[model samples]
Target chain A: MSVTSLASQLQGLAPADGSYADLFSSVLPAVIDAIGEIASSLSTAHRVALAGTANTFGDDQLNVDVAAELVLRNTLAAKCPSVVTASSEEDPVEKPVHSEAAAVATRPEHCYTVAFDPLDGSSIIAPNWTVGTILGIWEGPTAVGQPAEKQIAAVLGVYGPRTTAVVAIRLPGSSKADAASSICLEIGLGQGQQASQNSEVLRSSVRLAAPPFKTRYFAPANLRAAAQDGRYMALVSNYIQQGYTLRYSGGLVPDVVHALVKGHGVYVSPVTAQSKAKLRQLFELFPIALIVECAGGLAIDPADGSRILDRVLQGTDERAGLVCGTAEDVEAVKKALLA
Target chain B: MSVTSLASQLQGLAPADGSYADLFSSVLPAVIDAIGEIASSLSTAHRVALAGTANTFGDDQLNVDVAAELVLRNTLAAKCPSVVTASSEEDPVEKPVHSEAAAVATRPEHCYTVAFDPLDGSSIIAPNWTVGTILGIWEGPTAVGQPAEKQIAAVLGVYGPRTTAVVAIRLPGSSKADAASSICLEIGLGQGQQASQNSEVLRSSVRLAAPPFKTRYFAPANLRAAAQDGRYMALVSNYIQQGYTLRYSGGLVPDVVHALVKGHGVYVSPVTAQSKAKLRQLFELFPIALIVECAGGLAIDPADGSRILDRVLQGTDERAGLVCGTAEDVEAVKKALLA
Candidate 1:
């Protein structure tokens, strides 16, 4: 059976001009190109050549991380003129929060705000574990101290056995979270689909729905070491007793994305006194929250078990713990934590 | 930098004529072809289309898994005439134990015995986690119940951010375990490096040595559920209490390979009565043991403090848990188990 191109699908599902689809069409290529370049550069020599420079996040940036961000920045600037403001994990410059309407009112050309983590799970590169790129496109500059309710689109490119893209876009006039649609597309990099190819097709995509309840779950256990009290440890122990299997790679993208893609299971980042949440609100939490919510899964806030997307960003770099998955799994986790 | 072809490397590493290197050169393409095809088919629809039919080992055979194994079989039969007998995880066939010399004596054409898990960690596919293909090449039919020390060559193709091949060859003049040399190569399938491409250049080949001790490890905690007694559970608990970050993905290939690539850390699969041992002796255990041991690591037996490669395969389908990693890590695990 012939595969359908992702661009073609976007054309069918989205409006022709200046829509979420159009924005995705422009940004995805740039992202995929960056992935292709990054994929090729994760070599031994490349690792050795990287100066141990830390990013704004304090996680040491490998040469590849900075290079990937450049590819993204350059590609977005060239291809996505609608992007009025851009932010990235590589460089955390907290630009003033200007509404897209406000920015465009002043400079009528720009239409969107973009934020990303160009190369996530960088530490797992040496082990050859799955890692990814994440992009969050907003109708305007993201609100600094508010929930991520305004996010219009989220895309994740997971590099594993194959390069794949999971994209979710909130439809116009559909403000409800469930109104968003998501698709997983195979971005066949270097496999006939050259970096210059205008359209990479969907190998296959199914509308995501939370899978039925299962005992399987994924969580990065490293946070347990940082937890001040024994509460987080006790919760994980209880989950284990309930037969939840641990599937963590210490990578935020693949671990949470696994829950979204598998349609079941929960991925947690618990907030503890000694250990604040490791996932940043702007670059990590908000984007994943939007994506997971769009997939009929819930992203819960640890503070009050509210919808995570409704929990506004405390600051550009505010941190928050997350518990996201199918309703059953999330509820079970919440129950365990409460207990 | 122009990449060298894998075949060219084989030409330089092995005898000019027919040797284990030649055998590998002949069979690797077949295996890698299977990987490229499998990589293309891990879609949501592909997973659903596969009837939940379990394979010989009772693991549900995703249609893709069977298809992948078939690709391996056909490719091997058509390309490599040197293989006397072949076995795969999809269909466990116990072939007669025959030496390479004996097979050559009988067939004159067959020179090597090959066994593989065409798709290791198929269950992890839904989650988009990294998985792999393991190939074990022996001078003769693998001994039914003998240690893996007799392996002449081992290759592991890990499908993660990029598809990579790690090949270890036992040098002819060197009988010591340290005599083996392993190289990590990039098998650029369909990405300009066609199957017909004479060389698949080494990406970055390094003579592996265990990295200095670090308190990091990967163990499939789910195995604890299958453990008959609390011994395995107790040991894992101790590691966790000691702040050893858990890094299990329920995939043996990626877990063990992670240790090899990281240069430090340990990965263990303890034998429990209920779980006899999830890792198969022939296809999974022997190949990984050979690679890890060759890379200056230790593969230990849990029952007695002996090398896993030194233990004979009890049956064609014998299963044994594995504890492999840097010598020091393995020693620590051994001491804990004994305690």
Candidate 2:
């Protein structure tokens, strides 16, 4: 289909089932455009060329601290309505809370919340797996003036690949104790009508050209490693031994985005009840379940197989752990919770 | 990057490693485009307007079959040096197979081969699941005047979603069986790279949406069911108590794709070696070991864990009954077979 046809099709989405899709269609292009525009201006990755060169290009945590902040700033500045930004970074900066991006708090807090990571996979900045931007589409900003604790109801992290968006959302009405979310996919194919199934189980054997792990497979060790520190070595050291590399961008949005695109997986922060600081960001677009599922993957909280959407219904925001290719892969970690 | 930049970047991939990468990259876009185009033309589709109405589609196996063939034809046509062609649908034909086309021949002694299932999931075409294409990239096309048997050599299967590309090559300059293809990605992704360690284990609880059977993970169960035909449904029913939906597409590529995308652990196609005619379509991309491992999946020839690739190298392409996916998932079936 031609780009013109795709634009029209995207416009058509507005009429499909009311204005939600329309509103989404209208804003997505601009939001993505803004993301791309200012990303380079950020001081975070001046030396970096691509996200995958983390091992060779730069440092992971510094990458996120600089890049995520820059992305959040640019995204907030581009739009007029978005207010009270949150992040997977340090904590929810309800204005004074975060010294950076203070203009966001000054703006009106209504209609739209976007959670994202400007640069993903900062850990391997030297030889990045893939650095990306993740943004979640949200309805409205969280409690702007209210104490940091009394913020909005649902939110998630969104990631961007080259120029794609992936949202991991907090199902409507999640509580502080269960900052849960659900993931669905919305691939902008520009094509109408479609179909297919999800490959829930993907047993692939791969050895890297640069070999990180010997890549062996067994149950216990694999589970334990990820649970211990997903960013330690390779978050998973199952089939491919040599202890596959582990990665965390320090910013959750970018990490999740990388998972969504590259077919990795997502992770909840794995902290205790998320602090108001934890309610840092909320996603605005990108389906929560579909994207992960489409790539033959899974996304959910690791603490309990609790329906992630339901968890979002409960109260909580700062949750963390890896979501994998299958419910089994995710649940395996949940079931093995030593904590 | 702008569209021009993105396109340029993709365009440059052809020169990165070898002409092969370039050739593959050039054809991939066209291949994906063909799949999309054929999908749009499906007789059973709802034209995107009435898609909400589920049952308004057709059930023509021919259309499904043609779609797969079209992909291979068009894709191969995009690549020039490919001197000859062979397909499970038809015998070897000239270069540049047309879209929605195939050639069937009765010739016998051909040694070179390329087998494929153009469309694998017509059975569950409506619900938007279990429909896909499998392309086998083989070496040595059927000889100018040889039979089908003489032309079947290297195998490659390009499956959709859950499906994968299993490619077995004679490797560069070496013809010996052991000198066979090195471990390349079974599923297609340049080569293996380190995966996060967090994604190491599987959940303990096994929850399937279909019938329970030990050895059968997912695939051409029609052959297996027929093997146990008299008691096939009954046997399958007994296993159903486990809670899996026969969610299989009841088609070749579709079923396998569904199983893989859903991370169903193992996908089984247990047609006895004797049922050659029934199992003539499956294809491969890279060696199964590499493919499966790359996709975070596994592939086990029904017989044993010893390298199936090794076995296929020595054996004729006539061998059948392939089981593939996660190591553990396939192991369960392997143990089930012993039992």
Candidate 3:
């Protein structure tokens, strides 16, 4: 599809997750802290204020929480990921001034935020904060139930963020030696716009899904988050018990975008993906296949690896499925289910 | 204006003080019990779970204390008001039903819910559930500095169920002796839909600002306990003196709905209300006014006592303002402001 068509298609795809996963995920860690901060604010707000009991959330409390949560998200994104860019309520990203002074060279890969709401339903009244979340994204899923491991042996091999997980993609022009910058980088595509060779680069070092696998789906929305979830696999069913999370937020763009920046991939429901042939219809099979392979992962039909999208596009009806974890995880599920 | 149009016009336009006053008054009694129950629940929940160091809410060792205060708005709304509803997540308004026929119609006027937020912050996270809401909702705005006499002496004074206050407009066939049942009958339109001769109700409430006012705005989204809090005429806002609530949720419907139902009127901002006029906008005004007026409270411009959508055409701007207390309290605010 043309860039405009692709962008439109993606926008029409409903963020792959519902409402705003990024919005929620991005704000979670700070939200965690804000609960405490606001609690303090409320407590010390007054000692001699009221003679008796009055039930209410003083105005001062709300403002404190909102401001605190915003700061936490921004601060975490800057440090945790390489190219942490986002479109949130607080600030919009402005196009950087095109400085042609140091031109002629390949654009640097940028780091951005990749997030999944580690916590959902974290709300409480006057007293305490409820719920928790992790929003940064990453490369691939790991074995189920294993604590996220750290990169260096000395440091625990943790996959997601302490508060959130992150995700991003590697760029053709980027080099393996470009790991000096604290933040990762990425080339952000417009809503639904197909990624291109000329797009900016970002961190693609950590593959989101661990048990990398080749996969295919027919649902449009699920396909988006699965593909963007970085695992090229959705954190669909937790059957495999991998460390990677298969999230559902009820939107396509935000979910995918979230996964993209965090190095995770987006996903679609197997049923929706196959009925509309959404994934194949949107992405050229070979190129998408190549991209998934290039990202050091595998892709296949969630039902059965043998019945790949290229192999059996017309014969399937039971299409709802997941797209996450390592190749082994996908292969295991496919082996277990595909008839 | 026709009921439909009236409901539509008065949707967001609240007698700011009215709602505030109502919430404060209603919650006081409910709070007394809510705290008592949570003290038991937290202790039991922790005991049941057997988590270590998780201090039970009822314990005396902890210095946790919960109170609501109203501040700032005294100058802004004339009557310093803060709205609070304390109850368990369970709905308030319990009623004994004899048969299926009455059961359906007897859908309790309220549900019990303890939104007792932590008295402190993460400072209290050590006990986890230590900081949460104790449900309480009052229906009117008694002076913030008044004695507890007002809360205990209200028309609708039940603490077990969630509603700190329940608003009811007598039906064409109802009588004064059946006010509670009549009010229960109108729970659907109990907020501000049906008008009764001399029947005034207290909707939900909020809190915000610095010190002095006993109410504060914890932002409705976070004010879970308040959703079920309500009382009539004898409003709380009694004990905590910090400030009044300024509930805002960036316009999420359910959260706002809860506030409207439990509030004397709903409070929203210009962008949130999504209109240039506060009372005129349909989306912003209808739902809120329906809540406030149907319950017998007035739906006037918080700033000017001129009826909000009461303008002949009921057209107003989206600069959605605070839904003050009961008609009396609202007038007091305008009077204070004008004075």
Candidate 4:
């Protein structure tokens, strides 16, 4: 019934001298708080009412998405002052901040860049499927097209039947090493230890459902728009013939979270000749790659068979061919593509 | 910000002398209460911990499913003593109760049969997609093989990003008429108007969204096992070539709820050669048929293009090819099948 708070989890995340620990301790709690706020607002408000009139990146903004973006921005300004630059799928371009508040944060020496999709899959909200908020932390004040390898940490807060967080912190000099050298954890949110009369309060950071992963697969047909190609369709048909059940909800967060919890499965969003890839590298794919790799799974770029975490990010809008799952599953995807 | 409660909505549902209103008033609250219990349990407990070790209908049971079934059964026994016989997807057969207690109910003259899938799409829980609890209410303790038209009311409680209830009530001699003659309302659950320490649930019976639906579609490839057949594949290929995107998550509740909320789309589960129909008529198909029909949509058997509500239920396990959505969409499905 009791869950460890995110604060404590971050406190113990790294050694006292571990820079990654200090960086996460500075950043994650604020992002987690924003997730809690979004969950509350969404649980009660009507979906259409929350559909904001503004347009962002060719999509209509949900008012809640805007609120979530502000919440994260303000929280970073206050609690994670080391975060100097930020970009979000909900915003037109990366913005600079925290120059005034840098003195308050724990690590002033390291200026971190935060790339996020404050509310991924917001359109799916009307249908009442799961959605999530994603954040990736990298070295100070990065540009829009920074590569995934520059990242130090990645965290995803998934709001579904219940709220859960998946966090991955990469230690120094370990990008090429196996999962045993990295830190990956799934955190379950429970009632805050603070006994407030407000039922909306939540407690996060209980490390539960750590992954070894079971076999499963999830990819919306839309994500597999590439499947319209005979080659890609053949790849999908291979999975179907192999008895893989489709588990996509058209939401990146829940789809990836399913792999984390279930412990096995491929989530493919391949590039199509006529259309670009759908999952953005910085905002969506990179953070998920970090979490998946740290969880003992592999996130592969099907085009080159390179690790997703090592892919070159072209821009904030840059997308890639993604195939993430257990190593064997990812290999299966690769083999099918090549075949 | 305040919304109406289910109790208040149902109170105003039918005229004072309306027998349909009285039946729903006796039944819906009890079913909704069970839904509340399941949502609470599922939101807090671990999925594997909640996995009931027992298998039912040839699948591993989630503990929440068994608990949910018991909750519904007990609620019916205690609150709706007029419910004389009951069956559930979790239970193997129909069970009788309340022969003596029927005298204590408000509608003693009626013996209602309650058949339900206490937790539909429960297997999808591990992935944290939307799942729901469904109930169908029929007259005179109807047998498993009774026709769907014998039912006077139907309700489904969807536990998704938010909790919602969709109810359809048909007054006597109104079956032949269109949706205008029926009462279809979508209720949003908030804290009880009662001063309980439980969550603040209100209900909204807004009529913002209605049918004359847009063109969209959802059917899991798994349910489209029939699609493996050359003819069915051709029909599906037609939809794909026409640019209809796949939106299925293999959960009837959320899939249907999407159609209801978005005011569009079709959800199909056709019988395959290797397997019977994936959805049960009494538990899943019939109740949804009632709700779709009441919402100005249609539910038809793909085999003969007859209305789903008019089909004779062969037994509790009897299955049918389901095609539910707007009337135009249903006709499209009929044409595709017959072609």
Point to the candidate with the largest TM-score: 4
- Across B288-332, the per-residue lDDT of candidate 3 in tens digits comes to 343344344444554445554343222112234444334544554
Q: Per-candidate interface C-alpha RMSD? A: 5.1, 17.5, 18.5, 3.8
Q: For candidate 3, what is the DockQ-based docking class?
A: incorrect
Return whichever of 1 and 2 wins on lDDT: 1
Highest-scoring model, lDDT = 4
* Per-residue lDDT of model 3, residues A152-244, tens digit only: 000000011011112222222232211331122222111111122112212324333442322221112333333323232323223212323
| Cα lDDT of model 1 by residue, B51-117, tens digit | 3211122267776677667766766666666666778776778443345565455573446667788
TM-score of candidate 1 against the unseen true structure: 0.82
lDDT of 4 by residue, A1-339 (tens): 435445665676665666665475657666666666666666565544323211231257777688778877877776666777888887747787666445454456767888899888765676567778888988868845666668878878776666666777777776552466677766555533221111221222211223342334556335335336666666655565555667777778887776666555677766667656667788887888888877777888776777877666767887776888767777877777666
**TM-score for candidate 2:** 0.43
- Candidate 2 stretches greater than 4 Å from native: A1-73, A89-113, A116-317, A320-339, B1-68, B75-82, B88-113, B117-134, B137-168, B172-281, B284-299, B303-321, B324-336
RMSD of 3: 22.8
Query: What ranges in model 3 sit over 4 Å off?
Result: A1-102, A105-248, A251-268, A271-274, A277-322, A325-333, B1-339
RMSD of each: 5.4, 15.1, 22.8, 4.7
How far is B84's C-alpha from truth in model 1 (Å)?
Answer: 2.3
Worst 10 residues of 4 chain B by lDDT: B193-202
Docking class of 1: acceptable
Q: What is the TM-score of chain B in candidate 1?
A: 0.81
How many residue pairs clash per model? 18, 182, 268, 14
Assess candidate 3 and give its lDDT.
0.27
- Residue A29 lDDT, candidate 4, scale 0-100: 66
Q: Pick out the ten consecutive residues of candidate 3 chain B with the lowest summed lDDT.
A: B67-76
Report the CAPRI category for model 2: incorrect
